[model samples]
Target chain A: PDPALDDAIRAVIDGKTKPLGALGRIETLAARLARLQGTTAPRMERCTLTIFAADHGIAAEGVSAFPQEVTVQMALNFLAGGAAANVFARTLGVQLRVVDAGMAEPVDHPALVQRRMGPGTANSAVAPAMSPETLAEALASGRALGADGDADACAFGEMGIANTSAATLVIHKLSGLPIATLTGRGTGLDDAGLSAKRAVLERAAARTGALPPEAALAEYGGFEIAMMAGAMIGAAQARRAVIVDGFIATAAAMAAQAIAPGCEAAFVFAHRSDEAGHAAALEHLGARPLLDLNLRLGEGTGALLAWPLLRAAAAMMTDMASFESAGVAGKT
Target chain B: PDPALDDAIRAVIDGKTKPLGALGRIETLAARLARLQGTTAPRMERCTLTIFAADHGIAAEGVSAFPQEVTVQMALNFLAGGAAANVFARTLGVQLRVVDAGMAEPVDHPALVQRRMGPGTANSAVAPAMSPETLAEALASGRALGADGDADACAFGEMGIANTSAATLVIHKLSGLPIATLTGRGTGLDDAGLSAKRAVLERAAARTGALPPEAALAEYGGFEIAMMAGAMIGAAQARRAVIVDGFIATAAAMAAQAIAPGCEAAFVFAHRSDEAGHAAALEHLGARPLLDLNLRLGEGTGALLAWPLLRAAAAMMTDMASFESAGVAGKT
Candidate 1:
């Protein structure tokens, strides 16, 4: 990653009139920005937050509290600029794009990206989520529009009713972590609902075993999730920062990393969310998120919230005067 | 807090097209802002960051890595917008006001507040740092200019070479925590230097047992730290949000809370820093900081990083469309 600029970047960051490493993760993020764009004066003020929307077949398992219809409705909400991610994007001046990977119901908004894989995947408790052909189609749909701009970074988010169940099975297969460790109330389920969900997911995990990343996507991944994973791989290929939202989004990142291997170098885990399995996912990925506020929202809201920090990091590196310039004594 | 509006605020927040607490601490902060300003449209775009600069007597005890002269030098650096805090303030668009409380040497800056308490405090290990008279004067100096005008919020920070030692002793006397529990490397001290610092502080603590908050300030407070505590009191009195920096700033906040009793109602602990004694101080205060990046730079840099979150919170509350407005179904 530009070993020549490494010392220069450190000099710029260290020369800022603060204690060494005092700005903490800001400095880390700053260094990454410099490396990603291969410039100390990197700019990330323009961001594109793409929310991939689809429904999971596992909704039939009664795993999620919300109806599958909420997926289509939320995509419409995002297009209408009324969702949490919409507000956050507006606040951070990010452009929001809601891509329809596959929804049980069709969305009519012109703003919705028309890349439908299917109405929804098959119930993974009984059959695989999708055919390998559809999985590749979803992945290709995301890759086609990768970093299609001069924007500094791109964030990935997903919406699928019962998607958490799909993610649980995906991670279990990927990491060999126990299904019991992976299950959580997706959109607020009660004790009975949670138990019922666990039972259904446990059966799915036993049936699927530990499939490869591609096979696992066909087995348990939602179309929206597969699309997001593809989008991340593409963003990293284009050398743009990939911002992962909460649990479901992070699950997409895990899948992307499995396929692309080094895509995580461009990633920024936005928050250590309180979504049940998120901590485990973060731990397995060896990630330290930008914020940890017990957030469970799934629309890249956390990433939008963290967008300002990127600006701060870039500003500190580029706009801030060095010790040599400011005539401030170096830390001794 | 508006007990009557509590339900209303929740309805508004929960109605805002996000999940229940999906925004996490952002929602919590928004609710507080709404309650404090008595409006959902809380404004924090205009911020005044006041950094109090002074010298610590404990520097003579080999408690810090940097020499005392660095304190005044850093103040000049801050005025020139060369310090980390200056960079952060510029990034956040917050106006910075450097208040020279008591630097060992005078600074010539047109923007600096000329309320000098003294050249420096006495070596409190042998005698009191400041007289009760000077302590009162420092407090009055901060209170008199409490939220000088139109500024929405205030952040208090300090620049003293060995202020962490002063803060440790101050917290020890205020909370009766052990010297061992309270002491830490101020800037960057070696193992021998740390041990020597602990020995000197232990003797000082044994010699002067329990002290009231005022007496603690008179004994061990750096003029910058005392001024910061006073500024916090003033900010709270002005009903402006008090953006607290790292360890030294949090120590000042503890002192302010002890004196004013309920000023914390308007407080926002900026970050859980990586300083040795910060966590203990945070635990004693029961504060949940907005950010944590292993920051120990004591120039209000962390506080500036958090300013956007406040803005994001307010924006979500005011600009976001409710479920009804967005025609999205509520949780049922």
Candidate 2:
């Protein structure tokens, strides 16, 4: 932890707000921000949510029961405010922008921000799917959105069929873990399907000479994941708290961490999911998940569920009657 | 479920404000209320949180590491707004009222409602300590608070040291399950402590004759538990949603359900807890917990943590754009 940032955070906690450390994680995050900015009472206005929609090359391999077209449908659904994610964003009173970073179809929804790198990447099993230029474009798009949102806090969520397989490959390559350990039934695949998915990921991992972390992501990463990694870095550079959701978001966080070490300071693990690799990914990042519901429904649902706790934490920081304010004797 | 209440609930779900069946649980709760009250578009304006603070007789048996005095201290902590529950209630803008139905000390906080049934009960190992009169008073106090809040929704939470042992006994007797299966280390008790706790509860159950259902509660139940049960029944009578918390609260729900079969329609399990017996209690009530965070931290932390999801469900019911509204085609 940066000492200056730590001090700033401590000051916010110690401020004449609520009780000291009353707002558990929210206070912790706010204080950390105060320290990062070397100020007390750091403001957290202008929250932004970046919804990255992509199609997984691995989807063609039958990992998910839903066809790859469902990804495009859901992405369009997101833009149309019909999906669970859209409802959550609206309820949270947060600004939501949908990005079609790698959709196979030309997303016609007016609400969607068309930043397509291509009509989706080539199948990961065959070769390095996304090219260097596409990866760079995805990253640039993420940064551009962060700047555009002028977000004081930002979160990244993705919508794509079989993206978990793409995330599994990303995690295996980045964490240097074997495919079997990291891979599981992505979106309800059975034993045989899981085994086939693992084999495909292993083949993809080996094709790129265990492509050095950053290069590996550019090689095997989904357009959404790489772009989200960029968004994480951009949010951090802008001094915003980056709330991360389950497996795929963690993979993006890892990529972001690799690219910009300082970004870790801005990240908070929202929840531990039922997904097999989520725990390992959380452990690797030394992040404590806020909730541990067996939720595999991604689209930042887990994060949205955890939002009230965050607000409570902030409220505790701002409203709790501290030892001094209440004139209560502290632990002797 | 009442046929009238069921029809009322369906009407709310089919209201012109949103698409059919899009609001999910919120719509379900509203529709259930419609049937219960014979109206549609039921509103949940006034929300109440009845926090029951007590001292467990089991605490005298050295079941918990924290001294029994800590219960009073924490109860005071709650009234002083220094506890996690206080911050949560404040953030949700919900009214919180603490009831000292079984506290050993004369609760000093002016904010607390003095509904003390007794100073405290005797050790359950000796007998089914609380007399019928005291249990009745506690139950009435809870019911009165529920009515007074005029709440559209009500939630039950507790603040008592070593109360988990009391809850365990309630679970075992209510579910007719083995004490060992239901017992857990309450508030971080170790293996030895747990074994001793289990033995005490088993003995208490045998001594009490394990009274039948609701009647059993008067024999072995704490003031807080009994009061919460009354509150649940009162909320049901008011046609409000009763958001049930973990073990102890679920025990109250069970008692309420036994006394008033119609109350089951009003209850919503907030989360599947890490507590050993919580799942069994929820299953017995045919309730589905909204979140499953493996969290056993009592004091309504889990339920309060889940409030956002509940609000989101309501928001989705009220805010989501239908296919027609968004000009998007619905999936066939």
Candidate 3:
């Protein structure tokens, strides 16, 4: 970040018709946008939300409430415009794309972007999630795809069954937080199911010690998550804002920040999720997302909801008249 | 609100292609819209934001940071599409209207609606803010205007200099809260200025003890605030949603709730403001606003920022497909 440019943007924001800092986080958001684009006046008119679908081998361990086939079913739901993400995408006028990173079963659709690494990864309780070669390919594929997009910002959503289980283990390994504390009901697990999830995640987390970002991904990450992290880095490299969704997407953001140190400058966290581990993850990253509607739905819905605030912030910077221009008297 | 309709809406929301209660407050918001509209599928496509601009007599005691001339100036700015409210309204596609409730100076603009109750209220620090007749007319005018609007929802914004002091006194009288607790720096008061504002508000609040809604409004209220309260009631009576803005607007909502006991069914608290007393006032009303971005600007910007969430919530109820229709599996 450019300190001088930041000062200049603050000065510009202070001159707006509203009181100093009256716009609250919006003023800060505008400044961040200006700094990210390296301009006093930045535009964030176009946005795209990509839902990366995959399956987790840990689903066999009964971590999530939904069946493994739900991933493919939901991906098809996205294509059919029947899912919450699809409704939000249509409502917000955000371009929606479904990327098949790797589903457990083969599915063919004309609109699905095929970037499969494999059917899925090996069950992490017994072995690493993906091969080293698969990890590198997933990262490269995500990077190329993210960098090639034309939209000014990219919002990421994931639909991998039991992915929250995978995210919890990744978070535990990266942040060194206790595994049981970071684990929660992925969909709607009963008390007994939650206990089982905690047990499974504990066993999975015990297999890893402190490791690099790539190594951690090979151990416990989902194909969708690794790609999301890579995509965030790629988008940041291309100067596009990366709008991170709920828990799983935030895990991707944490991985992205670990792999590419400065890419967080391009991230705008969408909302605080109701998931058990999300708050800790956000706090670890020092992020204060825009919305906190208790949303735990990880389909870019929260990100999509926050998109207009970004537009409003940009409009406040680019369109609102300064006090002098509005011919309004300033403070006495 | 009908309990049966609420149950039916909850059942419908639960059937959507996400885990139960995953949308969190959004599900509550959607249920509210549906309940208010008396339908399982409620539509909130069109919204209008009306800014009631007036001068507050308490401004004469130097209770606010901005000069009283700002009331007229900001109203003109709104008409010129140069204010934050105008920009937000334009960006969110909400129709923006400026009403001269009782500006100290007459502003003759073709687009500005004149609902003048007089030049302004008397200095509430030592006298009743408005005549009983003026309060009645303001309330009636607001009711007619709010009832006549074509939009599905009406958002209220205010631009009366020193109005926060007036609102503080009103809240203290209505809610029986301590004066100092409900007073804050209006616009942008320095330490000494805030102290002085509190003293003035304390004196104003002391001039009347436990007055009724209309009596309290006459004793310590702005024309803009009184009109806003009436507008809220009028909108609620018409089965239109009332989106209440921050501190001052919320004070109006409180007054409206007092006057028409059940009108809160149509009320949607838009956001919590950064103002010191706003949280107490919101708490007093049992309101949980949608956004909490530390905003204190009062020109309906907070309300405007939250408009999309209402739209999104309504869309979730009306547009999103259920799990059965989407052919997605539910919880195990």
lDDT of 2 at A315: 53
Candidate 1 residues A1-332, lDDT tens each? 66779988887788776767777899999999888888878887778989888988889878887777788878888887778788778776889898889899888888888999999999999999999999998888877666577678898778778888988888888877778887887778888998999999988877855589989888999998889888888898898988888888887889889999988889988898877888888899899999987778788888887888888888888777676786666545
Ranking according to TM-score, highest score first: 3, 1, 2
lDDT of 1 at B169: 85
Model 3 lDDT tens row, B1-332: 47888789989999999999989998999998998889999988999998999988778999988888888888888999999998889888899998999999999889999999889889999899998998999999999888985888999999998999889988888999888888887689999999988887777777776799899988899999999999998999999999999999988998999999999999999999999999999998889999989998989999999988888899999888899999998777
1 or 2: which has the higher lDDT?
A: 1
Tens-digit lDDT string for candidate 3 (A263-328):
999999999999999998899889999999999889899999999898898889899999999899
User: Higher DockQ: candidate 2 or 3?
Assistant: 3
Q: Candidate 3 chain A, which ten residues in sequence have the lowest lDDT sum? A: A172-181
What does candidate 2 score on TM? Answer: 0.76
> Which residue pairs show backbone clashes in model 1?
none
Q: List the lowest-lDDT window of 10 residues for candidate 1 chain A.
A: A323-332
Error of 1 at A243 (Å): 1.3
For each candidate in turn, the interface RMSD (Å) is 1.9, 6.6, 0.8
Higher-ranked by lDDT: 1 or 3:
3
**Superposed Cα RMSD, model 3:** 0.9
CA lDDT of each candidate?
Answer: 0.84, 0.71, 0.90
